[model samples]
Target: MKKKFPIIETDRLILREVLKEDSADMFLYLSDKEVMKHMGLEPFQTQKETLDEIGWYQTIFKEATGIRWGITHKENGRVIGSCGFFNTHPEHSRAEIGYELSKEYWGKGIASEALEAIIHYGFQHFQLERVEALVEPANSASLKLLEKNGFKQEGLLRHYEFTCGKFDDLYIYSILKGDVVTT
Candidate 1:
């Protein structure tokens, strides 16, 4: 079953549903080449592209296929990034997790806080048995973050994704329901 969209709050951020108004903010980072380097996403060139992406994210929620949260700063209330679970398989009780933060927000612990809340929500609300993440082999920060959250490296997928005009290797990590211990 699809978990309803909920406004997840933490000490410094709020994970909420994306909005059309967020397109401009999304464009800020999504347009940066450095930010899109690891992921296979192209740097968006126009507000139209960001708007279209936002529309797609909304559609994902409406279709009950997946849930993506716009990570917003509580004090400023601007979306700094996004995180969510996709490729959900109700029968298997599993989902793939993905996330990205603006370069300015990197190393701020913002992603960790937001991720913890969402992971907790996934387990408690969706009753998921396992949650997985696919990260670029060189994405050290992400690897560390997943490890901090108890996700174990399962294996490597060679040439698994074509991103930034090249095939990229991905490291698979997973955490089971029984392994979750919310901090």
Candidate 2:
């Protein structure tokens, strides 16, 4: 059988891999300035930039270390966002997790659902000992989501990323295997 994503369903959403057909939907959300703010991106003014991102997702399966998941609504079947882990440190059996949701889907619990599912999948399928998420300090919602999902705030990495013309500090959070509530 072909390898399959966990394909989690939590009442309102389904989390799965990003597909070629999802380009337009991904572009729509990625192009929104407000949605793209915290996410490290200067809105895609050209369709090619959007296509490149989708293409990058499509090529993800060729790797053994990283995986990405698309978040779609179960009721309308629209892809509202994505979540996944990447930049794995094989020796330490750890990786960084990241996520982004469309503006329309904000304030809902979709981001948390997608994150929990992906974290579970990582431990279930990989030899991972821990998963880390680096969030911009200003993204309060993201900080809350990681906390609710059993991650603990580690500290800030000053000047972690230079995005949209300014240096941003990344607030690091980590969830280890079998953490009180993570497993």
Candidate 3:
């Protein structure tokens, strides 16, 4: 059986496993057309879509391969974003991570804090060999955040994702276990 992942906390946010109760909170970000603009994700039109996502999370947790975290504000106790390592390769000991936050909460460093906490958890508990992140080039803030958090830009993949009704290049960024230990 897979071990349960512990919840991670930062000064301003609590990164915990996503629960079905979080659908409404998640909709706050997923519903915003602009939030998904550069992300290649289309705006989720209904609650059922949110429920479907929740169902997927259940499978995700069971596999214990890709640990998912819902980002909630420490002060308000509101779920404002989701950030976690997904597409896990346990044998390879690596994972790809992704995150999305409500526009209302952008620019406050919450994403950065949450990301650091999750990355730390991935390393400490999973013995992750490496963690990778892919961001759309147009989303400068995300790209910048990854860079700020010690992820080095590995390369740009042509038409890496089909998001928001368009095919776009994705900038790959990564930090290895060895790099984390040294830095």
Candidate 4:
């Protein structure tokens, strides 16, 4: 049997499954050049692109490969961003975490909240021994968020990936299950 999509709730946010209906809202930020700058993809030019992204989210979940959640605001019920684990390796009990928030919602502690919820969920439900995040060195915001969440900087993978027409270096960050402090 397939597992149902999990819904994670934070104090002010709802991290739920990404639905096709979220395309428009997703497009709002995803189409922003600044938002997509470190995402390794060009800003989405059409709703069709957003839909494809949603489809990929569904596919990963269905295949037991990974999962993504639309980060919805509890107050306004708007999907202001997304956060998730991908490149999941059950055998190794590890996965890569990725997230993006609408620029409008940046610096408001939203990403931090959503990230905490998912890190907890990933460690518990996914049985993940390690949750990792790959971030461009220039992405200071993400680096700070990861560190605040207890993820340690592993090392830089130089020219690790080619995206958006150039090679980019990525700093890998990880939080081990043993590193988590249960409150």
Candidate 5:
């Protein structure tokens, strides 16, 4: 049987499946130079690109390979960002987590809330023993966020990823199932 897409809710945000309707909101930030800077992709040029991205999200979920949720506000119902696990390995009980928020919502504790909800879900629902994240060294905000959420930096994977026509080093951070108090 296929697993249904999970929808997680926090006090202020909803982490639900990324739908086709979210493309415009997604495009708003996906096309931002700053938001896509460390994301390994150039800013999206068109809504078509955003549609392709939404399609990728659906594909991964359908294949049971990963899950990406559109981060929506409880009050406004706008998809302000997205967060989820990709590169999932069930045999290894691990997955990589990634997220991005609109610039307008930065530093409002939104990302932190979304991360907390997803991390909890990942551990409980996905049975993930280890949830990892690859973050660029220059992304101080992400580094701090990971640390605050109980993810410990393992080490720098030198020249780990080739993106945007160049090699980039990324810090590998992970939070074990026991690392945080997940309920």
Candidate 6:
């Protein structure tokens, strides 16, 4: 069964489904090369491009392939980034998690807060037995974030994905249902 999109609120953030109105804010980061460094996506050339990307996200949800939420700052009411699970295999009870934040929101624990909520949702609502993350080798900040959340470093995949005009190595990290401890 497809899990419904639910609004998740943390102390400092709100995680909700992406909307057409979010395209402008999404373009703020999606168009910035520095913010999309590791993601295989090119900077959006225009707001329409961002809207098109949102359409793709809508398809992902409708197809039950994945779900992504716009991470909005509650205090300022600004969308800062996106986080979600994709590559879901219902038969295997597994999914891959991904997230990207605006440059200005980095190092503020916002990602951690949003991810914690989503991970809990994956396990409780979606019945996900395992959640995975694929991160670039050089992204220490992201690596630390996953590790701090109980995701263990699984292995390194050499030349795993082609991005930025070359093949890039990625590190796989995962946390199983048994491994998570609820607070």
Estimate candidate 4's alpha-carbon lDDT, on a 0 to 1 scale: 0.93
TM-score of 3: 0.92
**Which residue pairs show backbone clashes in model 6?**
none
lDDT tens readout by residue for model 1, 65-161: 7889999998899988999988988899999999999999998899899888889999988788999999998889999999998899999999998
Model 6 Cα displacement at 120 (Å)?
A: 0.6
Distance (Å) between predicted and true CA of 109, model 4? 0.5
Per-residue CA lDDT of candidate 5, range 23-45, in tens? 98999999999999999999999
4 versus 6: better lDDT goes to: 4
lDDT of 6 at 78: 76
- Where is model 6 poorest over a 10-residue stretch in terms of lDDT? 1-10
**Selected candidate, larger TM-score, 1 vs 2:** 1
| Model 3 alpha-carbon drift over 4 Å, by segment | 1-5, 181-183
TM-score of each: 0.94, 0.90, 0.92, 0.97, 0.97, 0.94
For model 2, residues 15-132, the per-residue Cα lDDT tens digits are 8777777878888888888888888889888778877886666566556567777899998787888888788887999999988999888888888777877787788777788999
Candidate 1 segments exceeding 4 Å error: 1-4
Q: What is the Å distance of residue 64 in model 6 from its true position?
A: 0.6
Q: All candidates' lDDT scores?
A: 0.89, 0.82, 0.83, 0.93, 0.94, 0.90
Q: State the lDDT of candidate 6 residue by residue for 5-27, as single tens digits.
A: 78899899999989998888899
Residue by residue across 1-183, what tens digits does model 3's lDDT show?
566756877788888777778899988788898887776667899988888877776687787767678888988787888888789998999999988899999999988888888887788888898999988888999988998899999899999777656789988999887776522
lDDT of 1 at 123: 92
Candidate 2's displacement at residue 177, Å, is 1.0
